[model samples]
Target: MHYTFSQYYIYVIFVAVMAAFSYLNKLNRTEVFSFFMYAIMLLFAVLRIDTGADYSTYIEMHEEAGKSYFTDLFSFTEPLYFLLLKVLYFFSDDYWLMFAVVAIIIYTILFLAVKKLSIDPALSLLLYIIVAYYFISINQLRQSISLVIFLYSISSIIDKKPGKYYLLNIIGFGFHYSAVMAFLIYPIVNTSFSKKTLTIIFILSIVLSPVIEKLFVTYLGELDTLYTKYFDIEEYMEKNYLALGKVIVPNLILIYSLIKFKSFTRYEYSIFMIYFCSIVYYNIFFGKHIFIRPGMYFEIVTILYIPIFIKKFFDLVTGFIIETLIILYYAFSVTLYGILINGGQGVVPYKLIFSR
Candidate 1:
């Protein structure tokens, strides 16, 4: 497939526009532009073709949906996910239409989630693009949807509603089994772990990564195909893996951010703790491709969290400098060259459905 890095400039331009509106401090225009920016992201997802490696995966799944989309719940496909396929089946056989509808749902939830949780929604959006969190929707449709559903349920986590939180995440798990990893969110966020315990876990995770992988396979590998098929360390070693840039490094910075900024509110602290679990996961599974995928469910929180970190932790001028530094890092390090070098998907050579 032809690949080009030029499509990333679109995101760069979006960030530029977002920064301009943010600095302008015009509530009405900023709100309108924020909505517009999200719409553009949704439209990008809707219009793309073969933008990611997995784009064809969903297309093939949709193509086969007529034969087996409704085979059984949890046996083959998740209920809500299968329903989406079936609904789109009636409208047209083309997967692109289903993709478009999914785009609307995914981006709508994401926009709403960021808008509500983020102190600066536009900055969150900018960070979303910078962090390449949007790749989930463009690439992994089912899990991305599942992830957003669980993200929407963050209120339950903040409100101390374990029953409600797990229920939503269980529903999310139906769509993508990986979301079951989120069950840990309830305990991690709800319970108060000391800095000592947190530090110990983080250190052990890095030092014990390979050991943990072995134990994971030894204990749970046979429990389900999830472990045997996906988490098999042997298979992972053989396949050509793609790097999404030193995934652990950015996360480690979050640890520093957490330590440096101690003024977080209860709500913010809950979010921080939730993300704290993700970093631990990444630290343990950093070098592997499959193992760290689940960690992304937590890493997405960085989009909102980072923006809040900048605003709360720095004065206006310092925040601007910090923000500029981050943007530069994203431009050269994360979003642009990082993804390009890693062969990360969804934002390259910007193909559209219309092109066909």
Candidate 2:
């Protein structure tokens, strides 16, 4: 019923094929290639069973939702997600069918967002896989859906439409409260900072991270709320070193981008600020796991931002080479991280709906 870590190579191989297809048809049929790539990822996600850290947990929630009253279910999960679960439960009590439906929604939006927004849609898709977004999607279904919705709202930010941006974020918050963090985006993007000021703030965020951690534990830890429940100050402070691994790459990118800040187009500048906010959030909550979820709203932009940076950072030939290297590194590092460090976020020994 279960497959080994080697099963994940199926994705790597398919992505390789997708990349080749994209390369070969980039000019004439890029849209077709994009759909093909999205379809394969969609299949992998939809067919998965007993995969992801929350896979079993979600199955349990589905079962509970079927039996519980709607009001009771709302108490357990966000209203929109539970409402969707209840509606799906009405048609068929099958959990796999419900999961498949959710997967479709998530991938459809992600595909559309990348195709519409990314400068290099193919590379964005590859980064989605390599950056662990794919893995995160399978595990954190609600937040993944919310994150994609926020991705769409990036346009509103660029267009200077705060109303549309906040409206989208409010809708996203219905699925996951984490979308509440997304309200910060419009302000972040709109705010202007000189290159000198930006560098100073970035350094201050790093230098003062420990003070921020201590302040959070001292102040926010006292709150008895759903959000604060995950704050294990003692355990996290000990693991403070672990947060570095997550932020280092983004921090490096931010430093590089800041050097060329003045050269950025309006759209690119907005994305850079969003990316910058992600780093600042990570620094502010450096060691804690729960606090960092807010930053994911901004961090997901890396799928788009990295390509933009590559084009800005280097000439065409050099950019292509650098991107290729990034892809290879991400493919290797992310896969091994899943297998060894993450254990697939409980996705290892992957199963299908009919595996049993």
Candidate 3:
């Protein structure tokens, strides 16, 4: 059975509660409630079944992990990725345990990352929901773990610990090869971009998206036979604009926030650059189908940035007008992603194995 609207509303209420707690906890200077909210999110993640685009695929992977020995596993995957799976599988082959392990790692990294980076943690979690980072985590298994490592390693990069930053991302790469992209944040964090440059780049990306899309597919397809099949430029071109429009308002708003809030700390700049690259590839490029998947790496930073963005942007003046826009903005984006986009395809109609 599909997750009904009632099930969808449950997630909406959950986001609202976490948002409220984040705001309150920030004011109160205690993270007790925020921690509880983190637990709730984790529980939801671990308990759910038959969710995510890769839910069944991961189950098959887990069974493989259960059967494969050390050497055989290494032939296909990074050592650590299979190692962890093997270690876990030694205990049981249940997919729930595998999901539990990944859920813990993701929520833990996100919880810690927000605590370190955001002025308001609850708001960050709220933005996480609205911006669909949490959904991405639920969908992308290996990359989710990779992203956790990337998020955790941001501080090391910001603090000028290049050795540690690179090392962490190297570890992340073991989970997903795409994680090597995290290495770029080190340089992007240090470089400066004027607002004019950012604006020009954004416009150029929009104009050249179709060209960029074709170029990327051709280049990557030359390197990998898989790319030709997975990154089909023609198939994506038709549907790309529709997906782009769904989140355009929020993307533009985020860009505005990044621009307005710029005096660029090493961390903020890193977040902005990641978000910028993703926008160029995912939104501006015509074949967002494939790009948006990877583009989410940068986009996830919006979760960390949004709380600070809202606090600073809206603090000077607060009113029904401001509050309504902000609230509606997030609620609409959540619907656009979770329902209108795909009937909450990946995460809605939450299910448990026992329930089934």
lDDT against the true structure, per candidate, is 0.70, 0.76, 0.68
Q: Which runs of model 2 end up more than 4 angstroms from their true locations?
A: 1-8, 11-29, 70-76, 214-245, 338-341
Per-residue alpha-carbon lDDT of candidate 3 for residues 33-151, written as tens digits (9 for 90 to 100) = 77877898898788888876678888888888779878786685666777878899998887788888989988998899888876667666766656566767787877878887887
> Model 2 scores what on Cα lDDT?
0.76
lDDT of 3: 0.68
In model 2, the worst 10-residue window by lDDT is: 236-245
Best by lDDT: 2
- Model 1 Cα lDDT, one tens digit per residue, 249-301: 46656667657756567788888877777777776765444565578778778
TM-score of each: 0.83, 0.87, 0.83
lDDT-superior candidate, 1 or 3: 1
Q: Give Cα distance to truth, residue 38, candidate 2, Å.
A: 0.7
Which scores better on lDDT, 2 or 3? Answer: 2
lDDT of 2 by residue, 51-137 (tens): 777887888878777777877755864888888888889999989898899999998989988887888787787777667777788
- Backbone clashes for every candidate come to 0, 0, 2
* lDDT of candidate 1 at residue 226, scale 0 to 100: 50
lDDT order, best first, reads: 2, 1, 3
